[model samples]
Target chain A: MNQKTALHAFDQAVALESVGTDTFCGRSPEAYANMVGPYGGIIAATLLNAALQHDERQGDPISMTVNFAGPVTDGGYQVVASARRTNRSTQHWFIELSQQGVVAATATVLLAVRRDTWGDTEVSMPHVPPFESIDRLDIGRYLTWVKNYDFRVVQGHFDPGGAIEDTGDSLTRLWVKDLPRRPLDYLSLMAISDCFFPRIFVRKQQRMPVGTVSLTTYFHADRDSLARQGDRPLLAEAHAQRYSQGYFDHTGKLWGEDGELLATTHQMVYFKD
Target chain B: MNQKTALHAFDQAVALESVGTDTFCGRSPEAYANMVGPYGGIIAATLLNAALQHDERQGDPISMTVNFAGPVTDGGYQVVASARRTNRSTQHWFIELSQQGVVAATATVLLAVRRDTWGDTEVSMPHVPPFESIDRLDIGRYLTWVKNYDFRVVQGHFDPGGAIEDTGDSLTRLWVKDLPRRPLDYLSLMAISDCFFPRIFVRKQQRMPVGTVSLTTYFHADRDSLARQGDRPLLAEAHAQRYSQGYFDHTGKLWGEDGELLATTHQMVYFKD
Candidate 1:
C-alpha cells in the first residue's frame, strides 16, 4: 500500500495553491476544520520548506517567527519569499503570505548550517505519557462540518466528555505525531497544530470550532521518535492570550518520546462554536 | 517621566468602520510597535481590553483567537477584524491586515466565559533553574540590538563563535522575564515573546542581532496574577526545528505562586544571527 495515497490536488483555496509553490496554504481539514485557522508550527514549518526550495538560500534554519499579520483566508493566497540576509552558518529570509495580490501574513526564517551532528548524543525525552497510552477522541462528535485529525493526548484531553476547571493552571503535556507518517513536514505539523483547544480553555468555557487564521512556530528539534509509529500521542498545549473585539493569540508545544522538546508552536486561531 | 502614552480608539473602527477595528493610521505608534503585526496578539490584547470597555464582553474571556485577512502595515496599511462565530460562553473573530490595498495576514480568536478560577492549585512546578540566583549575562555583549527588551540568561551564554557540527538534538533552559514591571499589555507581551530563542541555535549558527519576525503563541489560561509583582522567571525552551534549514521555535510558561499555571506559550522565531 502506498504511504501517502494521492488524489488530485487539493481543491481548497489555500491547500490547492500550495502545490503550485506560489504559496503555502493551510487548507487542512484536520481536527477542527478551518476551526482554529492555520497552525503556527505549520506556518513555521511550511515557510522553512518553501525557503529550502530556493537555491540562493544557505545554511540551516535555526530560528523563525511567524507574525500572524492578519487572517489568511481559506481561499488560496500567494507567498513571496526573499533572503533578507545570509551568513556562514545562518541565513535569514523575509516571507509574506498574501491573498489575491495582498499580504495576509508575514514570517521570517533563520537558517543555520548544521555543524555535522556532534557531541554527547543525549536527548532528555519528555516525561509525559506515551501517545498510544492516551485516549483518542473524534472531533466529529462535536463539530459536524469539521473533519477530525486522529489525535491522542499523552498528557491531557477533554474528549469522552468530562467536567473542567477541576484542574490547575490549565497545563498539559501531550504527544503529537501525526498518523501515516508523511515526513512530518512543518506545513502538516502546522495543520495538525490547529486541531485541538487547550483542554483548559474548552473545559472552563463554551466549546468553539475554529476557522481561517494565521500561525507561526518554532521547531525545537527533529522529533522523529514517533516517526512512522502509529498510535503515538503528540503532547500539545494551547494557552490564552489577551483578547479584544474578536481576536487573540495562542501558543502550543508538542512533545514525543523521552521528554524531548519536539516542537514549539503558536497559532492565530479563529474560534467558532 | 513618561515618554508618551498611547490610545486605541474603536469609536470609528469598532462602531463606524466595524471591520477596520485593528488597522494602522487608526492605531497609536505605541500600539503599532507592540503588535506582532497589525492583528497580532500584541494589539488584539489591547483590543480585548477595549472590547470589555462595555460590559457585554465581560464574563471572563476564557479564550479568544483572531483571524487576520489583510496586511496591516505600520506606515501605510489598513486593518480589519470580525467574529468567526460566537455561542453561549465563547466568541471568535476574523481580522485582516491590509497594506497599500492588499491582505497580508489573517487571524482568528476564541473567547470563552470563565465561571471560576483554579484556587489553591497544587501542582509540581516544571524544573527550571533559578533565574535570580544564576549569574545573569548582558545579552548586548553577544546580541547587541536587544535594546527592545532586556534579555538575561540564567545560566550560560550560548553563542556559536566558530564552526559547529551538531552532535545531536541539544537543549538549554533559561530563566527570562520582563524587565521592570510596566503595564503588561498585549504589545508588551508580544515583545517579550520576541525574546525567546534557544541557546542551542545561538551556539551553532551564524550571527546578527535578530528580532522576532513571525510569532505564534498559545495561551493556557487568563490570570489575575498580573496584578501581583512580576519577580518570577518565565521558563523558556528555544531549540531548532530542523537542521537542514535552521528553523526553530520556543516555549514559555508563566506560573504564579502556589504553582498555578498562569500561562503557557510557544513561538516560531526567525533568527538572523
Candidate 2:
C-alpha cells in the first residue's frame, strides 16, 4: 500500500487556534478551496471539530445542521461554539463561523452518549461492483477539494467540460476515501458526508450558479466502527428529489465496507438556471 | 361545512406572549399531548412561529431544524429567537426553548426570498388510495396529538396493541391533513412534516420509548403553491434507513393533491429496545 496519507494536512486544516473562552480561529487550506469559498465539507468538519475539542462538550455528535447564510471569505475565520443545552445523556450546541466580524455560516449540533440497543438496517445497500472493479475518476483539475480524495465513480458520471447527457435522473454513486489514506473519525466522517458533487451538475450536465444553502447530517456509526474502516473507501450514493423554484434537495447515505450505514445526510442547494 | 378547524387550537397553542424584545412565552395545550411531552411537531411549529412574528425576520422559511435536547415541561416555556446573520436575500436565526433556567430545546432556521427559476420534481408521488377511500386511523385515544390531525394509512399498518409483524422493509405511506380545515402555510407545513408516527412504532407492533432528537425540513413549494393546496389532504410517504444503536433515521416527503411536491423532511429519533 502506497501510504503517504493526507491525514496530516486534513488534521492541520481542522485544528482550531484557541483565542478566547469557547472561541477559536481556523482557515481553509488552499488544497481544498472551492470557487468562491473554502470547501463546505472542510468548513463543516472544522466547525464540528471546535465543538468536539471544547471544554464543555459532553458526548459524540449524533446530528448536525449547518446553514450557509452568506459567502465564506477565503481567508481566516473565527468560530464560536457554545453548548446551548446539556442533558444527562445528550447535549445541544450552537456554532457560528464569522469573518471580518460578519457571520458567514451557522450550525446546530446534537451530541449524545450512545448506548447498546436492538438495532437493524431497514434500507438495503445498492448492489454495485467491488471497489477494485471501478476506475478512479480524474478530478484533479475540477476543484481544490476534489483533489484531496480518491474517487471512483460507479454510476452517473458527469463530464464538466463535455457534452451534457440528460439522464433524466439525479443519482450518483461513488467509492471515496482520503487521498493519502487516513483513519476514520467523527471529523473525517463529517467531511465525507458533504463531499458529493452538486446534484445540479449531474442532472443538467453542466455547471450553474449553485451553492448549498443548508446541510443536515445524522451519524449512525460509533467511533469503534469508524476506526475499523481505517483508510478503506466508503460507498456513497446521493440523489435529488426536487430541483425547482431556485432550490433543490439532495439526500445521501454513506456506508462502510460491511454495509454498515455510517451517515445519512440531506442538503438544500440554491441555484440559478 | 363544520369550519371549526383544529387550526384554532393549534394557533392558540403556538401563539406566544411577547414578554420582551425577541423573547416570548408559549404553552402546550392538552389537545396535543404525547406520552411524555407535547408533540414534537407542535414544539417545532411554535419555534418557527416565534421567528416568523419577529420584526427582524426576513423572507420565508427555507430550512428549519429543531433539536430536542430534553423533555419539555408540561406547562409554559420561554423562547428567544435572534437573527444571527441577515444578508440581503437570506437570513439565519437561532432559537431556544427554555423552562425556568434550564434549556429544553433549541432550533435553527434559514429564511430566504426565493426567486423564480426552473424547477422539477424527480421523486414521483407514491400512488396511494384517495384520502376519502381509506378509513382514517382512529388514533383519537392514542395520544392528544393524534386528535389534532386526520391520518389515513395507505400502507404499512401496525396495531399498537397487537403482536408485532417484522416486515423486512420499513416503508409507510399515508394521507394526512390538519383536523377541521386550515389553509396551508409554513407553520402548518412545519407541523405536518413531523406528524409521522415513530418508525419504531410502525415497524414494531408496540411503541417502545421513542422521541425525536432532531428534525429538519426543506420547503420546496412557495406561498402561492401552498395557498392552492389549502386544507387539502397531502399524500405523504416516510421510511427509515436504519434503526440501531438506540437511534433511527426517517425521511419523508409531502405532495399536494395535484402531485406537486411540497416539502421534504428528515428526523433522527432516539429509541429504547
Candidate 3:
C-alpha cells in the first residue's frame, strides 16, 4: 500500500509533524536542499522520525548518534523525542533538534528487541561493479543534495570531472537509492547514512569547507531486513580514518543487495582549506 | 610529578570527583572490573572526565557518543556534563551517567578548536610486530579489566588458546599501554578507546554473551599529540561489521608511535549464544 504520490520526496523529506507530546515538527522541502542545511540524511531521517513516531518506541534502531549541533534553517524544526532508558531488551533515546529555542540537532537512539544471536560478519564486503556498470552521478545538476539520492560511483570521485587527482585514499564506492523508488524503511536507512562524499571530498585534491560534525549509524538491518529491501540499490562504502586537526573520520558500510550488513556509518567531518 | 602510587591505578580509575556545577562523582575501581560495569573504558573515561572538568570546555575531544544506558553499579556515579552547544569553532556536550536517580549512562561530546588544516591518514596503520616482539596478554589473571591494559598481540587472538581457528577476519591487532605507565592524556585517550578484545572474542572462537551497547569516539590526536604519547605502546586495530540480531559493530584504529592517527572508534555490541 505505498501511495503518497508526487514521487514521495523521500516520504516528503521524512514527514514528522506530530507537534506536542514529546514534540515533533520538521520541515525543509526544496527537495532535500543542502550546502548548509536540510539533508544531513534528511537531518538524520528527521531525527529518526522523532524516534519513529514514538509512543515510546522500543525495538529496532540499534544505535544512532547525530549532533550536527547547528545549521538547519530552511523552516521549522522542534523534534524532542525522549524515552531516556527503557530496558528489557533495551531502549534509550534523547533526540533534540530545536530552532527558535536553539539546540539545532542532537540524537542518541538505541532501541532493541532483536534476538536470535550468534552471527558474524567482521568487515569484508567491498567488491563492486554491478548496478548497471556505474555511470549515474550527474552531480545532480550541481549538488542540491545530489537530487535526493540515486548515486552510483563504484569508486572515488566527488567531482572528478576536470582536475583533482591525489586520491591517496579516502575511498568512496556507491550505488544508493530513493530517487523515485522509496521502500527500504528506517527512514531510508537514515538518509543513506548521510550520503557519503565529504571525507575531505574523498581525500584531498581540492574542495575546502566541509561539515558533518558528528554522526554514527550502526543499524545492521532488521524490520524484516528492511522489508526485504523493497527499494533495492544499496552497496555504499566510504572511508577515511583521520584527516586530522580540522577533523575527519568517516567510515561507512551499508551493503545489502544480498551481501546483507545494512548499516555501520560513523562521521566527524568539519574541514577547511 | 606523577605520583599517585599503586602506579596511580589507571589514574584512580579515571578520577572525577568534583561533585557540583555540572556534576561529577565517578567510582568503579575494583581495578576496573567488568562483566557488568565499570570498565566501558572507565565509563568512557568518566564521561570524558565530565567533559574535561567543564568550565564550558572548548577544544579537544572531537566526538564522543557513549550510551551504555544500564548496568553501571560498582559504586558512586553521577556525571552530568552539559554545555549543549557553545560554538565558535565547535563545542557541544550532554552527558548523563546517573545512579540512585536512574539514567545510568549517556554521552555526546564534540568539542573542537583544532585547525592546522589539510592533513591525512586514510586508514593504513596496521603494520604491527613491534612492542618488543609481542607476547603479553596473559588475560590479566582472569579479567579484572585485563589488569588495566598492556596488551601486545600484533594480530588477532583474543584467546586462540586452542581449537577455534576460523579467524578469517574479526581482526584485532594490539600493542596498547597504561599498565603502570601514565602520561598520555585526554583521560588516557578515553581509556585507550575501550581497550579492544571482543570482536566477538576476536571472531568466532568462543566467548559469547558480550556487552558494550554503544560507543563512538573520534579524537584524532591533539594536545601535542597526546603529550607526545608519553606512555608509549598505542597501535590498535579492531574490526567487525555485522553480527546480526543481537547487535555487533566495531571499527577501531588508534595508532601513533610516529604513524599518528590517534583515535577512531565505534561500537554497538551485545552478543549472546
Candidate 1 lDDT tens digits, A35-58: 334444344444556676666777
The candidate maximizing DockQ is 2
List, residue by residue over B1-273, the lDDT tens digit for candidate 2: 465463487887678888999899988667788888888888999999999999887899888999998888688899999998998888889899999978888999989999888778889997777999999888844787889888898997766767558777668898999886788889989999998888888887677888999999999989998989999999888999888788999999999988999999999999989
lDDT for each residue of candidate 3 in B51-167, tens digit (9 for 90 to 100): 877787888788888988888887786788888778898888888888888998888888888879778776677665789887888874456887877888777776656556866
Q: CA lDDT of B19 in candidate 2?
A: 93
Q: Order of candidates by DockQ, top first?
A: 2, 3, 1
lDDT of 3 at B255: 81
Lowest-sum lDDT 10-residue window in model 3 chain B: B1-10
- TM-score-wise, the better of 1 and 2 is 2
Each candidate's DockQ: 0.10, 0.83, 0.30
Candidate 1 runs further than 4 Å off: A1-32, A36-49, A59-61, A69-74, A116-130, A133-135, A142-148, A160-166, A173-175, A179-181, A198-200, A209-215, A222-233, A237-251, A266-273, B1-273
lDDT, model 1, position B26: 36
Model 3 DockQ vs. reference: 0.30
Candidate 3 lDDT, A1-273, residue by residue in tens: 456565477777778878689998877766788877777888888888888778888788888889898888888778888988898889889888888888978888888889787676766677778887888888644568778677888777767454667768878888888777778988789888889878776566566678898999989888888888788899988788778768788888888787888898988888778
Tell me which of candidates 2 and 3 scores higher on lDDT. Answer: 2
- Give the Å shift of residue B119 in candidate 2: 0.9
In terms of docking quality, model 3 is acceptable
Candidate 2: docking tier: high
Candidate 1 docking: what grade? incorrect
Error of 2 at A96 (Å): 1.0
Clashes of each: 134, 2, 0
